[model samples]
Target: MIQVAFYDIAEESLFDFAVIIAIKEGKWILCRHKDRRTWEFPGGHRDPGEWIEDTARRELYEETGAEHYTLQPVCAYSYLRQGEKASFGMLYYAQVDELGPLPAFEIEEVKLYDKFPEKKDFWTYPDIQPFLLRKVSGLGIK
Candidate 1:
């Protein structure tokens, strides 16, 4: 599992983070490493010189070999880790015209599921699933 930690303490909270749900042809794209077969959305820590949207695009392309996609911010949420509070994530919805081929770096394999798979097959950040399901089902954000 990827565990995020906060090393710096600030008076106020930090609220800048990003995640992307890359959707292609009505299916969502997820990636996993060889050792850990559980699938998750393609995302990571934002780089020093990149914007959140750029980070989402870069991660999506780097992990799934996907290009030319549209991204829209969906929602934001906070979570606590190791007794410290932090702005956990800002989730985005990405619509891709084509999925292309899988990129060799970072990602081992790409799995596209039509609907949210059984939770047993993978673990995801808490806020991701509901928004994704809503988007997939055309129900809008719940």
Candidate 2:
């Protein structure tokens, strides 16, 4: 399990995190773990002393069997969750040259969609939708 810590301080510490918005064959790739069963980008918490870009690269490889991609920072934002003041997120647009066979481990399924899914029950982070829309609209990353 991922562990988060809190401390009383004059300034807030952002919980550094990164995600890979991988696109392949004119489609976007998303995944869902059997435990969470929520659709999310391939990513995870950043390791201590790890560069943000490195975190994104490593998480993408670990979560999905994807390689040969490029990272472009799209957006950054902060929000509150579960009554905790947490801050952090870096969404990177990843263009992959190849889509390899993904192994089923923590991820139950890897789905590629031409258009974003319209399921209301799907687990998607709030900020991600807007970020994606902005990218698609050619407004550039915020």
Candidate 3:
């Protein structure tokens, strides 16, 4: 089973990885990975020497074709499993300003949702997505 805990952190934190919980005009942004038929936020492992927020930004643009937007750190989370080393990732909230055409690279397609989509992968729909949505709403987003 996957387990995670979240803690608020500075945007400039040195966390090595992250995922963006991006929204534009009141809709959440989700991506379909080329390798999996699953939808997830635009985020991943960070490049060496990259700041936590930059990782969120890079991943957002790379996955969603989001050029202009307001990105903020919601918190950092730790993923823990019974027999594995704990890993850290930052959760970011972005109000996308401009979204260019999605690049046909790692991500196959991008979708915007008013409410969380029910038909999604377990790790995303029930796990990652709801957690991110609560984090965003808890911060005052409707």
Top-TM-score candidate index: 3
Q: If the candidates were sorted by their lDDT against the true structure, best first, what order would they fall in?
A: 3, 2, 1
- Pick the winner on TM-score between candidates 1 and 3: 3
Looking at model 3, how many pairs of residues clash?
Answer: 0
Residue pairs with backbone atoms closer than 3 Å in model 2 (clashes): none
Off by over 4 Å in 2: 1-15, 103-105, 126-142
Model 1 residue 15 lDDT score: 39
Error of 1 at 61 (Å): 0.6
Name the better of 2 and 3 by lDDT.
Answer: 3
Better of 1 and 2 by TM-score: 2
Q: What order do you get sorting by TM-score, best first?
A: 3, 2, 1
The ten-residue window of minimal lDDT in model 3 covers 120-129
The regions of model 3 sitting more than 4 angstroms off are 10-14, 120-126
lDDT of 2 by residue, 1-142 (tens): 1223323222213547776778877777788887875687787788888877788888787777786777776655444456666656666778877656676567777888777656766755644554444553463322
TM-score of each: 0.72, 0.74, 0.87
The true-versus-predicted C-alpha distance at residue 37 of model 1, in Å, is 1.1
The candidate that wins on lDDT is 3
Model 3 lDDT tens row, 1-142 = 6687887663444466888888888788889888877778889889888877778888999999999999877788877777998778888888998999997679998998887645655344465557766777888874
